[model samples]
Target: MNNSYFWLRCRCNEDIVLLKDPKSDNRSRGKAFIYPKERSYKTFEIKYSNKLSTKAKFILSSFNNKYIYYAIDDLLYLLKSNPTEKENLLTVLYSSILALHNNLEINFFDIWIDNIYINEIGKNNRFFKVEEQSQTLTHITLTLFYRTRSPFKKPEAQW
Candidate 1:
């Protein structure tokens, strides 16, 4: 199914731009994906939700912060033209896996690349963005989600 994405700005601040998917009909998936605009996988998941509340979740906010950006370029986007950089990132990712080989199991999403890179706040490195000189690589973020469960069951308690 061919779907489209559009920007929705909150009334509090027009600068904020929330990428919304076109309304879905009866044919919809139950899962919802949330990530950057270019990440089409998440966009489709959101559109598949038939409920209005499901679609509204992305735009709901209590603060007056603006989400709009003149340019949302990041390292992932940069790697497209820079083969050397992409190779470097891939190598680093592989090295990370190898380094933790014996420690614990590392499970990745079906499409790991789409699950990585998230927006981060607070202090960042001293690298200044060329387009937005005032802004740094704050959006160049990575977060790991994990769950732990005991393999062995506990014995019966003493009387």
Candidate 2:
């Protein structure tokens, strides 16, 4: 199984990019691991379902206009320097986790500094509501690649 990954920055939105694998086909012999072909790439936008709460949207919106991307380590460094943001940051993180779990049934095993990003807002250290501050500290855009089957689930017919 050979899978290729690419990061694409859209001309219209520099802050958001698509981390894509052009050869993802479930019908292929090796799903999500097929060789690339000359077919046109299919692009899709990820939108949260209506199941997501208004509060969640409000929390995420606070991250708007922040930096295009920030690594987990960079956020950690920032938190270290400004300890006051710690509580807000954690709240955002937990909210994000719960939202994904409940809304999509997607469990993110790789939740680390390397896999996360913090927006560039609030760099000037301006004060905001706790909820808004949390969003500013924990807003992230992620592109995940995974198999259809749940890795954590037990096989129906165990060998």
Candidate 3:
């Protein structure tokens, strides 16, 4: 269970942390294991290896030594002041989700919450984009959306 090694990239500044061994590159040098949770859910475990991916390499370049909590706080403050700037707000939330998911590869959950609802944005497209809503600083409604789909979908009974 404690066998996997991981290369964690901090969400705030993309800081890279090489779990277990410190002498090797964060990417291309670890094996991530998927661990089961209390229910039927799965997570990842970190293991050591020597294979790196191009995406991992790009992530490693701007790796910092900090996490995303700090950035989230700052973004929250900005969102509070400028309620109309939609693009910047979404970027902040997206980066935070990425940071949370990047760390601890031993856990097998998705980076963001799994509450997905299907909406027909366009009849011709016939596909759904993932969307999540959060409260803005001034109690306004902020809806965030990404044009993507998750491969995992729990059974209806589980919901």
| Cα lDDT listed for each candidate | 0.33, 0.39, 0.34
lDDT for model 3, please: 0.34
Model 1: per-residue Cα lDDT over 16-64, one tens digit each: 6555464644554665433333322211111111221211222222101
TM-score of 3: 0.20
Candidate 1 clash figure, as a count: 0
**Best candidate, lDDT-wise?**
2
TM-score versus the correct structure, for each prediction: 0.26, 0.29, 0.20
| Residue 13, model 1: Cα distance from true site in angstroms | 52
Q: Which pairs of residues collide in candidate 2?
A: 66-120, 66-121, 67-120
Per-candidate RMSD vs. true structure? Answer: 20.3, 18.0, 21.0
Q: How many residue pairs clash in each candidate?
A: 0, 3, 19
Which residue window of length 10 is worst by lDDT in model 2?
A: 35-44
Model 1 spans > 4 angstroms off? 1-30, 33-78, 110-143, 149-159
- TM-score of candidate 1 on Cα atoms, chains taken together: 0.26
For candidate 3, lDDT tens digit of each residue in 7-58?
6777786858657744544575555422223322222222212232333223
lDDT of 1 at 82: 54
